[model samples]
Target: MKMKPLGRTGVMVSDLCLGTMTFGTQTSETGGHRQMDMALAAGINFVDAAEMYPVNPISKETVGRTEEILGNWNASNAARRGDYVLATKHSGAGFSHARDGAPISGQTIPQAIEGSLRRLQTDYIDLYQFHWPNRGSYMFRQNWDYDPSGGDRDEVVANMQECLEALQAQVEKGNIRAFGLSNESAWGTAQWVRLADETGAPRVASVQNEYSMLCRHFDTDMAELSAHEDVGLLAFSPLAAGFLTGKYQGGSVPEGSRMSLVPEMGGRKSDRVFDAVAAYLEIADKHGLDPVHMALSWCRSRPFMTSAIFGATDEAQLQRILDGKDLELSQDVLKEINLAHRAHPMPY
Candidate 1:
């Protein structure tokens, strides 16, 4: 459980961040609390949530339930409220369940922070992130046919300036300690960094994006941006939505698995995906490593990784992931992994 600096904020967070997307839905409150205890015992000091969470199948009825569960934990452990770093997101436009699908703007920053603070039962959020760009994003498998030609340049920059000004106000108000982004592009992040430099707002500390053995979109341009800008990546879906666990191989969809609940696996399922999985699974088998551990270890080895975010539907699964928390890949294993990547690139 090595600690790393979260960009330029001077805040040290665990290399592994506990993800709570399934809280209040697949996992009971007791289970979520127990998982937190387990994570803390294992030295994980970072946890992440979103306002539109519990999202295997997001619904209007369950909006904000995850934050409420976390709030309960905070109340029960009031003495240890300062023990961990908390991160949450503001849902972007087209999320119908929140704010009637409104886009993020200067006016919405304080309102969203107030709601998160009340629900989290905390004085200030360690990291407050925008769930996605209001103009739109290429994340969540949307990059295949993405087009950037429709955006108005002047309007985008103006909105960013306004939002940065509002975020600066929130910093003064002690509502949030740091700011971040998710599902954003290299160009978008560059603009935010430039604006924050000029406006004296909270500099972007991190960006949460999907990175795994099967998904390596962050390895190129985004990786370069992180190297120079100091914006570390909080990697989500490091297991490729559980595909790297080999539970979905041979066309087998286990009962109550993510595939069973959402058949498309968030646009990750395809004929090439299984073959790619098989290749990596073989590499793990050859080295006598658990595929889950291999995938997670590989993510942590990246130069731009701040933390690898992982979630479990049950305590047993959580414990299984924690078992390999100390495993480090050898240079030989890493070499084979690079070869594997060349053989099968972009399976999703």
Candidate 2:
């Protein structure tokens, strides 16, 4: 339960963040609440959610249910509101369920924040993130075919300035304390930082992206940006959607598991992914480490990581990860991990 600074925002968050994406789906309301209690008891001080959550099967009908559940928790425990840092996201383009498929322009910022505030039963968010740029991103297994040639540089910067203006207004109105991004590239993050400095808008506090043993897209350029800029990485899917936990190994999908329900696992199911998981599992075995613990501890060991966001459907799964929250990997384990990464880079 180590705490780290969330960029230049001057807010401290736990080394591990509790992810509530499964609040209304895969996990029940009571179960989600129970997990929150356990997370807090374990000293986790950061909680992350999104408007379009419960994403095992994201549907319009259940779009905002996750935040509503969190709101309910906040309403009943009003006295504990200041005990933790709450973060949520504004969905960008390609999401048909929000604002009738509106993109995250200056026009959508206020509305999105209003909706999130209403649902969360909170006056202000500790961190508000753009889910992804309207320009699209390489996250969620889109890196292979990813193309960023859609927009002109000046036009993109202009749009960012407009969004920053809107965000500055939010900051002035006390709607959001800090700003962040998700599924962004190093260059995109730099642009946001540059614009914020130039326009007196909020500098980014974090970047929520998929970073795990199987996904090292953030290891190089993004790592450098995070190191110098102080925008620490909020790594989602630190378990690689259970692939790093070895649950989906040997083609055996456990009953009620994510892969059993959503076979594609958001395009994470592949032969290469399995092979990469095997390599990590082997390393863990060689070092007498639980693969789950190894994967999570490895994430926290990164220099640029502020927190590694993780989710679990039940308390047992949660407790197992919490038990290993303080594990410090040996130098030997890290060496094997680098070899594994070099062998299976970008398995997805």
Q: In the order shown, what is each candidate's alpha-carbon RMSD?
A: 0.8, 0.9
Task: Give per-residue CA lDDT, model 2, range 1-348, as digits (tens).
Answer: 789999998899999999999999888889888888899999999999999997888988899999999999999889889999999999988888998778898999999999999999999999999999988899888898999888899989999999999999999999999999999999999999999988788899999999999888998999999999999999999999999999888889998899878999988888999999999999999889999999999999999999999999889999999999989999999999999999998798
For model 2, the stretches where C-alpha displacement exceeds 4 angstroms are: none
Give the TM-score comparing model 1 with the true structure, all chains together. Answer: 0.99
TM-score of 2: 0.98
lDDT of 1 by residue, 159-257 (tens): 999999998899899889999999999999999999898878789999999999989999999999999999999999999999999999998998878
Tally clashes: model 1: 0
Native-referenced Cα lDDT, model 2: 0.93
